[model samples]
Target chain A: MKILLSQSLMAYLSEPWPWYVSGGLIAIIMVLLLFSGKNFGVSATMRAGCSALGAGKINDFFHFDWKKAQGWNLLFIVGALIGGWIASTLLNDPEPLALGSRTAEHIKSLGLSLPKESKEIASGFLPAEFSKPEFVFSFKGILLMVLGGFFVGFGTRYAGGCTSGHAISGLSDLQPASLIAVIGFFIGGIAMTYFLLPLFYKQILFPLINELQNSFPK
Target chain B: MTKAEVISWYRIQEMFLFENFHMYGVIGTAVFLGLISVQLIKRFKAKDIDGNEIKFEPKVFSIPRYLFGGTIFGLGWAMTGACPGPMYTLVGHGYWSMLIVIAAALFGTFVYGIIRKKLPH
Candidate 1:
């Protein structure tokens, strides 16, 4: 009986669930959060973390009773992390992820290419070039990772919540501010992808790519 | 699945660029349904498990704050191809490089905590 149960669990993990299953689960969680009188946001966890670490002494923002008020949010982050790990590992899909042809063309247009050694590109998930230490340690990588992180951190707090909080929870509550914020997010995204990103690639990345290609000659 | 394929879908970068809208549609619909359910319960004045009335209060409106924050957040999203919520998922997918972005984000938050008093509330 135990063996049967384990086999079923393994089978369940191995196959991808329909999109609605996850969507329904999120909806349920959101409903629960609403009834419980708690705001569902991920960025706020950092504030709770700061409060737990005693940042209240320096600023009123972090002065909340984190253990009583914001503790559960921390657990949510942990759960998300654990859930992701389980999904990626135990239930790991044997097949490589598939990419839409349009997306492939779009990425190619951006002058991005995967390393030759990687077989994952055909499957369409993560690019080895982007994930490698050499890429991350490069000047362009540092700019994106470091400066981008700073922007996300400062912006989420300044705007009052991150994507999940504003887009999901705040939108659900029908907050006008969230609507405006979402619009702004889209505009920024469009501007980056169409204008700023291409400009960066042309001015900075192209030169790097050229230099690397010349040096490697493969 | 290949890491690149997973990252693309999870981050939804190409989708956003190409206007696929599948990711947005799913999230928006689910969230909207959740919102409608909450509204329904509130209209009925339903009590939670603890018997407390559910409240949905809109936050204060600050144009400048929203504009600044949203724009910066968008920039970060574009750069990293992941937002705060998805960042954890990226890490869970074994993209350890995401740790760099996460650490930097935490530091940014810490910095904000230090100087928040000087900023407009």
Candidate 2:
């Protein structure tokens, strides 16, 4: 019975739903959050984590009553992680993620590798070349992860939100700051996609791929 | 998990790479719905679940502030190919290297905490 139930569930999970199904669900979540008098974002969890660990003694930003201010955000992240695990492992479709032709072409043009395409490497919705440990622990990987991570971390806090915070909730709230932030995000994204991204591939990742590649994401 | 993979792919990958219109379709739907919902709620003066009057706090707009911040975030996001939310989901997806990004993001947040007062809000 359990196996039968899971099989049916898997069938539903694996099929692609229309964009509105997900989009409508996302909007409903935002509406729910608004109705609860809470704003949503992912980066806020860092502050809560720090405060929860009593980092407030060291830093005022972390010195809030995190249990009151940002406790729910932490739970959100925890739930996301566990829920992701369940979906990735148990409820997952055995077939690899299907990439659109354009994206596949773009990945190849940029010299990026996808693990889903490679039978030996196992990954879920991540670029094998940039995300796998073999690349992560090396010179190129270190630069990419460290520099990229620093930008994400500092930038989100400085701006008062990340993608979800600014783009989803902030915009939904109809704030002007969010509009500017959203524009900036697009400009930066475009610059990276067209300009910095090519340079990174040509100067760093491509050459690094030639020189290394030892382990997998397992 | 489905949300993370499907949504992140469209949001970060497709949008950044200019791959297709699907990302736009999805995001636009959400934003449109959200805009309408917010308007209706305000028009009705809907109270929150706690029965407090729902409010939208006015943000101080400075051209340089959010622009710089968001651009920096975008660069980081493009390089990492995952934003703050999906970084955790990627970890659950078994991309353990995302831990490095997670640690660095926390450190960055801590750094921001240290200098929060120095920067203009």
TM-score of each: 0.84, 0.87
DockQ (0 to 1) for model 2: 0.62
In candidate 1 chain B, what residue range of length 10 has the lowest lDDT sum?
B1-10
Q: List per-prediction Cα lDDT, in the order shown.
A: 0.71, 0.75
lDDT of 1 by residue, B1-121 (tens): 1122223432366656764554565566667787888689878998776788877777899887787778878887777777776677667767777788888887777788788667765
Runs of candidate 2 exceeding 4 Å displacement? A1-9, A118-123, A204-218, B4-11
Give the Å error, residue A142, model 1: 1.4
Highest DockQ: which candidate? 2
Cand. 1 Cα-lDDT: 0.71
Docking model 1 quality class: medium
TM-score of 1: 0.84
Error of 2 at A55 (Å): 3.8
- Candidates' RMSD to native: 4.0, 4.4
Residue by residue across A1-218, what tens digits does model 2's lDDT show? 99999888878776554577767777887788788888768888877776776779998878888888777778778777786687667666565656777767766777666546544323346666645567678786787788888888888888888877888778877889988888888887788877887788888777776666644342
Candidate 2's TM-score: 0.87
